[model samples]
Target: MRLARFRHDGRVRTGVVEGDHVLPFEGDPGMLEIIDGSAEQRTAGPVPLDDVKLMAPLQPRTLRDFVAFEEHVEGVRRSIDGSSGVPEAWYDAPTFYFTNPHRVYGPDDDIPFPARSVDRDFELEVAVIAGPEQSIFGYTILNDWSARDLQRREMQVSLGPAKGKDFASTLGPWIVTADELDPYHEEGFLDLWCTAQVNGVEVGRDLLSNMGWTFETLIAYAARDSRVMAGDVLGSGTVGNGGCLAELWGRNGKQDPPPLRDGDVVTLTVDGIGSLTNRVVTGPQTGDLPPVRRRDQAQARAERQH
Candidate 1:
């Protein structure tokens, strides 16, 4: 079953998507609750899909994004850090980072470009929403918008992808229940093709099977010594051979194609799930916010002596 959270007649409602219409439920029993088997799939009336405004399928309790694609890692490292190979530890374990859940964007929403970014890029990925008994409730498309310039500068500190990645992440259109994808499951991996398009032009494509680490493995790693509760979201990072402008430039040595600009429509599609489309719009200028600065260790020691 495909489920969606939307606003109709100025009130937010949750519903199961049936074709182009949604079978609305009476109360707002959050998507997570429905996934946990606490809420029933009862319907009230059908609402036309075009009449309602879509929202993120659910408000995630926590968001964890993992780097599970080797090609993506290699391409990024070679492009940004001049490295020809991945880190040795990456082979032994899945690595991930927590992102701001408050900045989530739903399908058809306009994503504002971060003020500090000149090189904005989109990461095409798939994400799983956790349900009861450590099982997956549903799947959705995830677009991890990145400010590559900010990310590069911050990584120099060896601590974070912080402000660089916390700006915005896009999810939804709707969630496709695990049962809907059972046909595609084989040997613990779902065989689905994921694609990304910029303004209707195909830019990247890859199969979910290309991922080096499975979603189950990534979730297990995340749950170690930590509670993986309902509503927690785990992203399957960028797919193998997915193209961001940086990776394209690194591979082809062509920089003529510009980075994401205002009015660019990015669409990510995963075969079994659905397509998530978002537009890029310029945001309000950053006023009075200082640019990032490097801390001088020598100057700090001299000040401590005083």
Candidate 2:
């Protein structure tokens, strides 16, 4: 089943998409309702899809995105640090980071590039929403927006992708139930054809099979000493090779094609799952920010934790 969340008649609603129309669910069942198998009932008839404004599929309980592709890691390292190989520890296990679930965008939405950063990039990926028993409820296209300049500074602190990434994420058009993707699944990995484009020009294309770790491994690794509840969303990080603009191919870590700018449109598409597109816009205003204090004026010693 393909389910979508949209705004119709001045109200946000949940519905099932069939062809060119949408069948609104009774009482606006959401992600939780569908996952629990309770979103079966629907309104009397179907409504044309053009009547509603689509929204980001769901607001996840937790968002965890992983670097599950070796080629992506290698390319990113070369782009950012002028490095040649991935860290050995990366192969030890699938690693991920928590991103803000509150800020999300849907298809056709305008994505504001972070005002403080000059380098803008987009990551093409697929994200799965967890259902009952931590199983995948559905799949959707994900565009992880990035401000590479902020990311570079943040990572230098050895504790980041926070200020850089917590800005925004795009998901939707609709969610395709897991069973619908069975034809593409092979040994816990999907062989989906994925592609990314900016301003109608193709930037990258890759197969999901190129990922270094499977969703199962990501889920299991995430569950270590923690619970992965329903509604949690996990991303299959940037697809390897030329999956993102940050994959530099220049001397001294310089970006070749340059970063995204205002008026650029980014679209990510995956076979079976559909596509998600957003336009770049000027973000909110910037305010005065104080830099870190000098080392001499820094704290003499670390304080004990509470």
Candidate 3:
């Protein structure tokens, strides 16, 4: 069953997407509840899908995005630090970072370019919605929006890329229950064919199986010293084969389709899960920040620029 959260008649509602329509749940149960088989009853007949506005699907309790793909780390590292070798530390385990869950977006939502970014990029990947215990509820296409300029500056400090990736992340169309993808399962991955298109031109394509770490391993690591709640989300990070512009630039040393501009539309389509699309828009402007606090750091910066 494909599950969706949408807005209809001025109220947010939950439903099961079947073909071209949606069967809204009685009392509009939360997505996690429906995933657990809590609400099996429907209020009325199927509503035409095109009529209502689909939401981000899951209101995650936590958003943990992992770098499960070696190729993603390899090329992105070169783009950021100009290094060709993969870090030895990355081989130890699945590494991830927490992002603000309150800032999530849905299909057809407009993503704002970060004020500091001259380049707009998107990471094509899959995400698993957590179910009861350690089980995965389902899958959804993920658009991990990136701001390369601010990301580089953050990486130089060895601490954060918070502002770089914090602005927006689009998820959904709907969630495809794990059982719906049973046929694509191989080894441990769904091995689905995924593609990205910018304004109707196909830019990248890759199989989900290219990632080195399995979802189960990543989930276990996430829950190792802690706990993952029912509505938590875990990302597969960027798949290989030009999933984002930075990776392509690192690999080819040239920008092909160039960075995203205001009004540009990005669509990520995956086998079994359908498409997740969004538009880009200019963000609000802000004032400047204060200079570096430490005199020694300021001197080092002058020397580096010199």
Candidate 4:
């Protein structure tokens, strides 16, 4: 079953997506809101999916993204220096980040380009949204929009990814339950094609099976020392050989990083997982953009940027 959170009338509630409509899951809030409820007992309201705005299915209590793919890790490192690869410890330890939940956006939203970013690029990934606590539910397409310039600057200072990666991280039109994609995790060849389209033009593409680490390993590592709540989200950093900018933009080492311009639409689509489409817009400004108003606007804005 595919799950989502959306707005109807004036309230924001969680729902399940079936075919062309959205089924309202009115119970508790967050992942637990739907995870804890039964689909058999769910009395759904049919809202034309086109009319309802989609939000991230789970309101992640703790959002942590891991670098499960060694190829991606190595590519990023190589881009930084002549030769940079994943350390032995990285294979042993599950590396993660505490991202701002406020930064997460829904499936069809438009990601905003921070004022600081000049070069904004996309990272195509398959993020695993945990089922109950430590269980690996299934995978969803992820677009980790990056500001190359800021990231490089911060890395130079050795206190990186702040502000650079904090701007936005996109996830899901629906959280594909593990059962649906069963054999992929265990038996048969779980081959799925993934691609990225910028304003209808293909910019990147990759295969789901190309990653170095499996989803099962990610789950075990994530739950190793700590407890992952029902609504928590874990992201698969990026995929092999596909770089929206690291290779395309030459790592911003040569010149100014390219920022996402207004009207640029980025679509990260996976075979069974569906497409995660978003537009790029400028963040809100002062004068009329108050602090509280900005944050509120950001949240609302995030819903559309996804």
Candidate 5:
């Protein structure tokens, strides 16, 4: 079942998708209702998905996206050094970031390309939302659009990716229950056909089998010390073999990359799950607003406690 969250009458709601309609779910994290709730309990009010505004499927406390694709890793290395390689440490170290899961885009929602953004690119990936409040659940399509210029500038300060990735991170038409995807989940060879389209034009495609680390490994690594609660999302960093701009080819055009323009629609589709399309739009601002609310504040507080 495709589970989602939406806003109607100024309040956010949880629901499941059935064809063109959405069925509302009443619970804390819909995952609970999905796993244990009866068929009737799981079903609720229905509305046309196209008519109502969709929000991020889950209200995650935190998000961690990991680079699970080796081809993408090599592609990035070759772009940066011309050596076609990275240090051995990269293999051992799974790089990741704590992003604001609250800043999610829904189907048909408009994603604002920040004013500071110079090299805006789309990353077609799979996002995972944890279930059982402790166990890692599964994966879904994730489009981690990036502003390369801002990312590069901020990384030099060593406080990095904070300014770069904070604007927005897109996820879900809905969260697919783990059991629903079990048949496709394997050590190797999960036929994950994924692709990206910008303004209705195709740009990228890849398969899940290309990833360097499997979902299980990512979960084990992520669960080291931190408790991964229900609704926490994890992204399969840019897919193997040029999944996004940085990984694919770099600085080849006249400018860095085309900043997502107003009305530009970006669609990401994963074969089994479904498709998520978002329009590019400027967030509420006078000129170029200060970036959206800071997400790292919560991370900072978490770190202080430790």
Candidate 6:
């Protein structure tokens, strides 16, 4: 079953998608309740999908994203620091970073270009929402918007990516339940094709089965010292060879392409899951934010003090 959250008849609702229509729930059955098996699938009349505004299927309690693709990790490392070797720790265990849950966007929404970000890019990925008893409820598309310049600077501190990634994330068209994908499971990975498009041009493609670490393993690691609650989301980081300008530039010997510009539309699609598209728009201008310090300036200032 495909579950969707949308605005209909001047109110928001949760419903099951059928063909091109949504069978509206008789009551507001929260997504977590549905995942926990407490909510019934009773429905009212069908509402045409085109008639309602889609919303993020659910607001997750927390979000963890993992780098599970070896090729993607190697490519990213080579792109950023000119190294193709995988870290020993990465092979030892699944590693992930927590992101801001409050900054989620829905399919078809306009994503504002972050302030001070001149190298905005998009990451095409798939994510699983947790269900009761350590199970996966469903899968959905995730677009992890990044600010490359900011990311490169902050990661030098030995900390994880922060402000560059926390500003925005997009999910959904709808969630395809795990049971629906059971037939495609091979070994521990799903046999699904994922792709990304920029304004109608295809830029990247990869198979979901290419991930080195499975979603189950990633979830297990995440729940090791804590609880994984219903509505928690775990993202499979960028697919192998996913094209972000950072990777593309490195492949082309460091010449940059124009970063995401205002009015550009980005679409992420997974074979079984639906497509998620968002338009990039200019965000509020930076009013009085301080500029980041340059390395040269900092060194010169230290010499003067001595």
Best model per lDDT: 3
In the range 49-135, model 3's lDDT, one tens digit per residue, is: 989999999888889899888888888888887899689999999889988788899989999887768878999989988888888
Task: Show model 3 residue runs off by greater than 4 Å.
Answer: 36-40, 295-306
Query: Please, what are the lDDT tens digits per residue for candidate 6 over residues 1-306?
Result: 999999988988999999999998888798777877898879999999999999999888899988888777776776666776688888888888998899999988998866788778888889999988778889999888888777877888989799789989998988899999998899989999998888898878899999988888878889999889888999998887654556666565563555788889999888888899999986887787699776798889999999
Model 4: lDDT equals 0.70
Show where candidate 1 strays beyond 4 Å. Answer: 254-256, 288-306
TM for every model, in the order presented, reads 0.93, 0.93, 0.93, 0.81, 0.81, 0.91
Candidate with the larger TM-score of 3 and 5: 3
Q: Would you list the clashing residue pairs of candidate 1? A: none
Cα lDDT of all candidates, in order? 0.85, 0.85, 0.87, 0.70, 0.70, 0.85
lDDT of 4 by residue, 28-60 (tens): 255555554333336466788888778776666
Task: Give me the overall lDDT of model 6.
Answer: 0.85
Candidate 3 has a TM-score of 0.93
Better of 4 and 6 by lDDT: 6
Could you give candidate 1's per-residue lDDT for residues 34-136 as a string of tens digits? 8778887778888899999999998899999998888888877766666777889889889999999999999999999777688888889899998876778
Better of 1 and 3 by lDDT: 3
Of candidate 3, the 10-residue stretch with the lowest lDDT total is 35-44
The TM-score that candidate 6 achieves is: 0.91
Error of 1 at 217 (Å): 1.1
Better of 1 and 5 by TM-score: 1
User: What's the lDDT for residue 201 in model 2?
Assistant: 87
Clashes per prediction?
0, 0, 0, 15, 1, 0
